[model samples]
Target: MLGGKTPSEFMKLPIEERENILRGYLVTDDDVQIEEGDDFGLFNKEIATGSLLQQEYFMGEDEAGKQLVKEARQIYYRENTFSVRSHWLCEFICDTLADGKPIPIESLVQRIIVRVDVEDIYDMDDDMVDFMPEGEKEKSWVVRDLRQLLEFTNAEFIRIEVSGRGALDGSDPQTQEKIKEISGIVKTLIEQFGEKLTIRKLTQLNDGQSIFHDLRSWLMLE
Candidate 1:
């Protein structure tokens, strides 16, 4: 710690010197720094450390975006099926393709299975959400991203699978309803965009499905 003297004498220093001193303080204090002051701290070390346990790790937007390209490689580099956790993943893939950022590979990615969570599936609404503050009507990323993503891409047969909640054949009534809703959503995408998008399978979003769909590329010899 810089101790109590920095705070007491902070105003005595030149503005540039003050900035340098503060930056030095931040360099020592910011344990969760991703870049720049995104709500940086002036808290006690022990308190800040404890608070960090309840928080998520921060990623700068540029670093966060690199994940999309990494994921695209996981899909198109060898096999074509890409299971999606968030709807945003599918949207990013479409952009990478449409923007002419081709993924690197030795062979063709003829078929792709882009899986989305059942809870994450929906046609985005245009109206401002009720919870949003007035005059701050930011449109859903889904409208510009996932919904528009399917219209263009490199794959010939892109299967959009809906996973999570419960299976279509499961006994759970609530899960069955979600599956039905997802079926309708997928149907609209197909009807509007033609047969390029299809749903060949429904998998769970839990541990079992995670292993099967995500663990080892469907565990096949292809």
Candidate 2:
């Protein structure tokens, strides 16, 4: 039905409706066809060509326009494999954070929250596993490194809450040491990336408790 319409008619439709139609057409195998003189192929080259032309026209020919079309293609064509998505998100994080501008917490959470994994951040062996039966194959590895967690998750601001009864009272030696280690890692990250990375330690008027929080909560104010 969409293919039968002229470009002007199609452009007259609501943008959301047009997008839905394009998404369906991009992934459906039924759209492909062959003429009497056409060569054999997995999909209809003519349809694919037309789809790309439409995307280019709608998205424009600038760098940002190309990226928009690419992202749309990835979604509509089912070309966004896990690895591809992770890599793109990682690059986006690096570029955005490196720009020295304040980033919206909501955008970070919505875009990168559950989509990324430990493997996407670290260079680990595919077969690495914590445990396996004597004759069984290795399972997937888990995320054990705090640095990888901070970097991959794009958590630049971290809060360490320490409980104590008085100003003189402080955290235990082990907790203090661990906090120092984490602070060192954060400092290294800031040195490498920029001053956008920060960590804060808060002393609460209590004991026997410690908590960590991220700046994601600020999204509420935003």
Candidate 3:
């Protein structure tokens, strides 16, 4: 058997044993392009090609469908849920943008594209029918535009932080200094956002749960 023996010992064993003990190795050459300077041939080839070509095609279709679903969901949530659609929340977002804060698109998407209390929503509306749009849901043009604007605003904040007069060592700094400056900017943005944006408190008990509870009660009556 290959056992725990070294390479020499494994070699001494039978061919089958040696094969069992063999681990893969990679031999690199000096001419190999291992860095950014290396050639990166580019073409607009579709993703997931080869035998999985169908899967690739399906990916775009599925993505488009998902986007539609998200748009429908946001519209529904905005119309129905006070907890999600409070004036305070909108102001918070506006203030964050105004204060030149940089928030990631992925993070924002995750926050909006979820139903925190689907069960609660259902229980509140006994006659409610959960009907989704046929085919995959696509994102609304409005949401897409808003997201783009936020991303652009974030980029501006990043630029200001890196190149502003307040920046002690602005441009052409060493890698270490650049990293430190960026970290400081991120921290400042976080602090500004926290000061303005307050999370909506959602409790299981309906008693005295903000004005939203009253809204839900009225919705239930209607």
The best candidate by TM-score is 1
Error of 2 at 182 (Å): 2.6
Residue 145's lDDT in candidate 2 = 33
C-alpha positional error of residue 118 in candidate 2 after TM-score superposition, expressed in Å: 23
Tens digits of per-residue lDDT for model 3 on 82-167? Answer: 11221122332332211233322322221221112211111112222224244522222222222222332222121111111111
Best first by TM-score, ranked: 1, 2, 3
lDDT of 2 by residue, 127-197 (tens): 45434445533222212233333543443332223222222222445434334433444454445545444
What's the C-alpha lDDT at position 101 in model 1? 44
What ranges in model 1 sit over 4 Å off?
1-81, 94-110, 119-146, 165-171, 179-185, 192-196, 204-222
Candidate 2 colliding pairs: none
Candidates 2 and 3 compared: the better one by TM-score is 2
lDDT of each: 0.39, 0.37, 0.24
Count backbone overlaps in model 2: 0
Clashes of each: 0, 0, 10
7-104: candidate 1 lDDT, tens digit per residue = 33434556566444334322232222111222333332322332221112211124322432233233322232333333444433432331344433
